[model samples]
Target: MTVNGWQVSGYTHLRELGSGASGRVVLATHDATGTPTAIKYLVGDVGADASFRNAFRGEAELLATIDDPNVARLYEYVESAQGAAIVMELVNGVSLRQMLRANGPTDPESALYVLKGSLLGLHAAHSRGVVHRDYKPENVLVTAEGTSKLADFGIAMPVGREAGSSVTGTPRYMAPEQWTGQAATPASDIYAATAVFYECLTGRPPFEGQGIIVLRDQHASAPIPTDPAPPPVHDLLRSGMAKRPEERPQPAAAFLDILEATAVAAYGPEWEERGRRRLAERAALLALLFPFNDPAGGGTAVAETVLTESSGFGGPGAGTAGLGAPRGRRLGGAQKALVGGGLVALLVAGGFGLSYASLEGDPVESSKDTDAPVVTDTPSAPVDPTTADPTPPLPPTPTSVPTATPPAPTASVGDTPTTPGRTPTPSRTPTRSPSPSPSTSPPPPPDVSPPKIGRSAASPTVIEPGTCPYGARSSTISATAEDDRTPVEKLRVRFTYTLNGATNTVSMFPSRSGVFHGVLGNLPYPKVITRIPVRVEALDAAGNVGAGTVIYVTLNNYCTPG
Candidate 1:
């Protein structure tokens, strides 16, 4: 089947992992290497645009450069006339957002473990001068082994550069300076990371506001919540999320020392190990909700083991088949009680008074209600997709809107209404003034339009294979791009051709002429006739994208008969 207008080639589509406005992530196996991977692709108009493709390529390039264990790895990036795709390491685990939603409020040890891993990852990026502008739970992935790694560097920027004028990032976790449009620094990443650490400990973010404007204000001046965590961990949260960037740790690496010290002092030397175990357990639980096929075909078996061993719900014969069974026959009394108790613990742990929006789908929106907390009920055992019963509906989650209080207007000094120096007559009856109502303007809708990519062309479209028998073949490819509003941020060209029995690909960057130029050398000597494929893309500052035409260069070579 075709995905986002491109034919599925060189890989087998396994199952969909998740989807968002930008695109969908899917589980797939590479045909050549037989390795499973998570492939993210742009969709519809965004995929068709060149600007988004450029951004996608940029992300790929950044990922390819980083080699930290706590960061997701990049495998391949494919760009063609039809679309663009990124092949990345498929993390065999769930996002930290999903973990918190499944089991509210991690213990202090576990919270520290998560933070330490995240910090290490952020430090790796910082050391490379890359700042993850969008650091949050959703971007942190916890593998089955309980190792937490940072994912989704789509909006990452260099350390010294400002991301942009428009505010970008989740409202609740943004740093104070980020709200003020300052350049993203390692300190900002630490701030956002600490916000997530607070969520892990308290089951909710540190601050709550009715809307984006208020949320920004809260981050700027709201008191850091440390009561959720023990006294020992308070300093870490405070210093990491200090309102002033100067007050916080300078680089992300510096905070690691403090965190480890605090963790060791409070939870002992083995606190990290304990925390990772807890995370692994949580990840195991999440697998039941979002099941994906493993390239090795044993993912389901391992999941069943984790479920039965951890919850003590099902026995050997009581396989996941019962998950699709009728609701009444699915769970026994003891199993039901265990599941119910777990849910209650989650609720109690999450009773921090602040509301939390579900982090399952796209970035949390300011307008969405955050009243009813998300709960992961006891689901039936996961059945094979082919033979599985129709999945049961999850319980309805409640939404709550915070009541907004308008600010009291203050009278300016010496501006009180008075007739010269005459005393005002006392009123027969005093009237009580009503409190001014708060304005309830909704945040503006996000920009979703893909950037426009201009048509591209290649010079000397035809090349004789024998002409480069002992040398290289060179060609210049050029393309332009524009966005409806934002300026074109980047443009890239991917040149792919088959040499011998393997495929070779190269990425080309743009020059001063607003055109991407590259030289393709070491072309295979054509035995008879051959064709090479090439594609170009453009990206806008906002990450909206578009692509250009796919062209092929024909090479003709023939040996003259003696």
Candidate 2:
């Protein structure tokens, strides 16, 4: 079956979201499971292009290997003699590009929040040796929940490998090495991310010109705009956009560290939460502008209606609307009816139109209203150092030992020389002695013990049921860790929970100081009892690892009887 002239057999096509140079994106639902998904297809002449086809397929393959909260998930890739299509998770949010255009520049805290998510996503790709060549605002999708995810891996390639001879990527955000025809590396990705970061701060790109050549030159030599940003952010922009690739942060993870430190120092400990809440508010406001019905269609009734009416496009009732017109002449009574029907379907079905065509230059369509509640700005209290556990120091280096001095040389004389001259006895050859061997220092003690995970607890072990928004149950998880031979470098908490019968996991960041503390907000679903299993991992400077005991928290909507 086909929906809107696109040949998709198992999935029912709802509407066209947008069209770009590569292909078109459409909203579709699976016939068997009834799952709503965004299908990107290489259509018409673009589908025939072998290179575009290969890239479309390549994007799906690359996405398959990545599974992170900050990156969009890929469901499946279908290819045929006619064209190619990629089925991916439909993020119900606005693009960062649109957000910037609508809201201008973001505050420092909000920008840092977005940057942190982007860097984590990029780090996931870099860990697998993949480089997102086209890292720009257009590819970042900010969901209604205030979570930012990286999208459009169409131009993504392996690290140290070139996509082709021709340079690819949005010129404004391209790195200096990319302009010079060098292979895309983690550093290059960092450069592009920083460019976006600059845009988030200044409401404009660092370098802009009339043509690609001028843009190239500007990126190669133009000084980064530090005047718009506060003093603390200047160093970040400078180091990320350094002219030489070697000077930039090698891997995205390294840059992420610097960004987090800067954010905390500038905005305080609760900076991330504040920024995310701001994004959530902005996203909610954006949703109000373009309201659409949910396409998932609660049951078979809505689904059947969409399928039956869409299939009747060219029937007797087809001419009743203006959809049957050959070209662009004029709409008659029947044409008007058809157009009206399609528009109604578009609105009711919540499918996107071609208005999202310009992916590179213009903003694209957002998803249906999530009805998620507005997150309030609640600053976290300052952590006390005296109560926190201290990190263990590394072992000392082995001391060196002095070598013994050689024995003093003794005088020697021949028997005949004594009678010839008294002076001859004085000139005796010094007896040779083997030089003492230098003492070798002992090897330093081996780092065998892993980091030690101390006590861990979650505040308010039980949450009241009926939270306004899914996943908004506010709580905090704190833990202490230590190492015998090295200082603790990082602490991470993984939360595993079941939402809508599917298991989902999210990684949470913890503060340093041999203690881990993070807030858990917004449960993924509403009015549902969820048991969240939490695990903590600590890593020392020497790479030793320690895992803490697992704990479970329950969300209950039921109240106990009096």
lDDT of 1 by residue, 367-411 (tens): 122111121112234333223344578989988665598443344
For model 2, residues 1-562, the per-residue Cα lDDT tens digits are: 3523445455678766655555567766655445455666655554565665555555555666676878765555554455556655545566776566544567789888998999999999888767778788878877666778887665432222233445666777889888766667888888988989888876668876867777877888878878878788999999999999899876888888998899889889999988897786555434433323443432322223232444332222222122113211111121122223221122211232112212332212332221111111111233333335566688899886645974443455543553454454354666789898887988888877787777777654554332332111344555777777654443333444454566655444444233455544445344666676766666565566677787776766553221
lDDT of 2 at 534: 68
Model 2: residues >4 Å from true position, as ranges?
A: 1-6, 43-46, 52-59, 156-165, 295-562
Report lDDT (CA) for all predictions: 0.57, 0.59
The C-alpha RMSD of each candidate to the native structure, in angstroms, is 28.0, 25.5
Where model 1 places Cα greater than 4 Å from the true spot, the runs are: 7-9, 44-59, 80-83, 156-164, 295-562
Q: Which 10-residue window in model 2 sums to the lowest lDDT?
A: 370-379
lDDT comparing candidate 1 with the true structure: 0.57
